[model samples]
Target: MESYDFIVVGGGSAGCVVASRLTEDPDVSVCLLEAGGTDSSPLIHTPVGAVAMMPTKINNWGFETVPQPGLNGRNGYQPRGKTLGGSSSINAMMYARGHRYDYDLWESLGNKGWSYNECLPYFKKAENNEVHHNQFHGQGGPLNVADLRSPSDLLERYLQACESIGVPRNHDVNGAEQVGAMPTQVTQLNGERCSAAKAYLTPSLTRPNLTVITRATTHKVLFEDKKAVGVEYGLKGQRFQIKCTKEVILSAGAFGSPQLLMLSGIGAKENLDVHGIPQIHDLPGVGENLQDHIDLVHSYRSSSKRDTFGVSMQMVVEMSKAVPQWITRRSGKMSSNFAEGIGFLCSESDVQVPDLEFVFVVAVVDDHARKIHASHGFSSHVTLLRPKSIGTVKLNSADPYDAPRIDPAFFSHPEDMEIMIKGWKKQRQMLESNAFDDVRGETFYPVDETDDKAIEQDIRNRADTQYHPVGTCKMGTPDDKFAVVDSDLKVYGMSGLRVVDASIMPTLVGGNTNAPTIMIAEKVVDSIKQQYALLKQTKTASCEPS
Candidate 1:
């Protein structure tokens, strides 16, 4: 068996960061295991390539949710990144840090060190903002953040429509306030997607201390007397074991982390019994507390195809010319992240912070773009920033290769539906503004634009995920029964193991999760380093003058 100081399972966003940061100390050796292949594909580097990958399975673990009663018994798509950067490599590169209130809420819920103030340094440390030089942003960081190389005029019109209806223009949503409309700040450099792999792992690839094994799927976390010591994985149809002397970090995202826990017999006793696996530690909260953003899209066909993307002949010819432009200069249509403009709003006047968000797409994205439209169009995604409904990620079977059963019981809570209904009506008002009068055509899925029941039914029929899934292995105080990990990201009742990904978020943030997930990795690395430092000092003192 190959041995290393640390082994990080899952080469996604968090795993890449952990591996890169740990190997900075030359003596530390880390082996990163990724189920998917590399992120060197041009499809992953191009911002617009998300359109092709979101609905398909290229470098994506295209998992589907169990039939959601909340969605009238319809199964939802759950696409996660399978490669080095994880979902960050496949997602629309919107660089949102979420509302400051989100982290403060995490601290309020008994997680002492996760307050916005405490986490801000990590967020800044991970970012290298090309434009904003404010106190909230940082420069010379590994991850690059910049405005879109080429934004659509209709996106400006969408912002205008929001302003026309009283929304302010927030130049920097990642700055002080998040309540307004603005062009999305993306994780890009020179108009290319800067996935976590590109930002962190790519730079550290040559370091002899760090080993990244792609196409390596972790089957279980090997343990001895309830302490994690190594990992069992499969590569090229061959099983292998790698020992870890220090720690085992699980960063396989929200779904994969909980699934791996159960596979390792560290979950509920009943769950282990059902799977016919012997139990090690019974952590019932391993797969509970699943949360995700449920989004309702409102799309309309565009009268003119000048600025929109579609399958029409006009767009085909335009793309022909546009491809060469992007190839030579890395600009034009191919550079767009599609979901370009964003708006944050409150459902009611009494609400303290914005509870709803809008993502303006320059294409007709129906069914997460699975059902392609034949003509040019535009859409706006109305997403609930905070959802009240709870969900779970459970094992489908004992087999490690089988996909985990994902049930994001969306809209199970009456309050979630109530808020979505209100948001549905509000988006219509925003999109109906005169700013889009020249381009807007018929709605993609028409409802009685004013009737509450029609809008409610419409929301039920079409609402789905905005691609942010978190809180499966949530962080909380030891007293909290539902807490899976502690403030230091250590798995409760277990040693030499930690979860450093979106799965550790106690609650869903108010915006896109990619940036926040990267921030989580950044913050957890400090704790990991400090813990080892204290151990080293204790060991030294114990040996001296005793």
Candidate 2:
């Protein structure tokens, strides 16, 4: 069996950062296993490649949820990245840290050392923002964040529309306040996708102590009586085991991490008995409390093709010219991140934090863009930033390859549905503003916008996930029985194991998840490094000329 000081499973957003930073110590040996291959595809580097990746499995896991009764029995599309950078490489690349109160809420939930004041350093440590640099933003960091190169005129109009209405304009959402409209800052460098792999992993290749294994799927965590000592994985249908002398970290994302734990018999005992698998540890919270940002999109058709990625003969010709423009100058329509404009707002003033987040796209995106439209158009994605509904990720079968049963339980809560309708009403308010007169053409989503009942019906028929799923293996204090991992991220009642990903979030944040997921890694690696140092110190003391 291959052995290392630390073994990190799932080379996604958090895994990449953990492996890279852990190996910074020349003495520590680290091994990173990625279920997918390298992040070297042209589609991965190009900013506009998300359009194709949203539908194809070239770099995506392409998991589909069970039929959601809330969305009129619709099975939502869940496309997670299956490559070196993980979803960070496949996501919209928005660099948001949620609101300051979001982290404070973590502290309030019995998770110590996770407040906004404590987490700000880690956020700063992981970022290298090109435009903003202050007490909030950072420079000379591993993650590269910048503004979009060529935002569509329609995106600008959307922001103008936000201001034209009562909504305020925020230049930086990741700063002091996160309650207004602004152009999104993306995780990009030189107009290319700066995924976690690009910012943290690629540059770490020169370190001889670090090893990254690609296309390796983890089957289970090998246990010694109770403590995890190694991982059993497979590649090309062959099984292999690797020992970690110190720790085995599950950074396989929200879905992948919980699924692996349940497969290894560390989840609910009742569920394990159903599959006839022996229980290693009975943690009922292994796959419970699943939360996601449920979204409702509104679209409008426009006449100009050059302004959007919508279907048109002029768009085809313009795209032909865009190819060379990107190949040479790295600037043009190809440089757009598609979701260029963002807004965060409150449904009710009594609510302290904003519950609604709007993402303005340059093209018509519906049903994960599966059903293509004929006309040029733009879409406004109004997502319930924090849904109260709960869900689960249960095992389909004992087989490791089988996908888990994902039930996000979207709109199961009556309040969530009401909030969903309110979010769409806000989207309508922006669309109806005069800012869209020169650009906006025809409203196509609600059909009838004024009726509240019609809007609620529309939500039930069309609402789905915004691709941000979290809290399966939640982080909380031990008093919370269903908490999977503690404030330190160690799995409850287990040693030598930890979960570092979106799954560890006790509650979903208010904005995009990619940036917060990376920050989780930066914070947890310090914990890992300290443990490694103690292990080294104990060994040195024992050998001191005794």
Best by lDDT: 1
> Candidate 1 lDDT, tens digit per residue, 1-546?
899999999998899899999999898999999999999888999999998889999989999999998888899999999888999999999999899999999999999989999999999999999999989999999999999998988988999999987778999888889899999899999999999999999999999999989998899999999799999998888999999999999999999999999999988898789889888998989999999999999999997687888888899898998899999999999999999998899999899999999999999989988998788999999999999999999999988899999999999999999999888888888888999998899987878866888887888788999999999999999988889999999999999999999999999999999999999999999888888889888999999984
Best by TM-score: 1
Backbone clashes (count) for model 1: 0
List, residue by residue over 136-216, the lDDT tens digit for candidate 2. Answer: 988999899999988887877888888876678999988988989999899999999999999999999889999899999
Clashing pairs in 1: none
Q: Model 2 scores what on Cα lDDT?
A: 0.90
Q: What C-alpha lDDT, on a 0 to 100 scale, does residue 508 get in candidate 1?
A: 98
lDDT of 1 at 437: 96
Computed on alpha carbons, the lDDT of every model, listed in order, comes to: 0.92, 0.90
Off by over 4 Å in 2: none
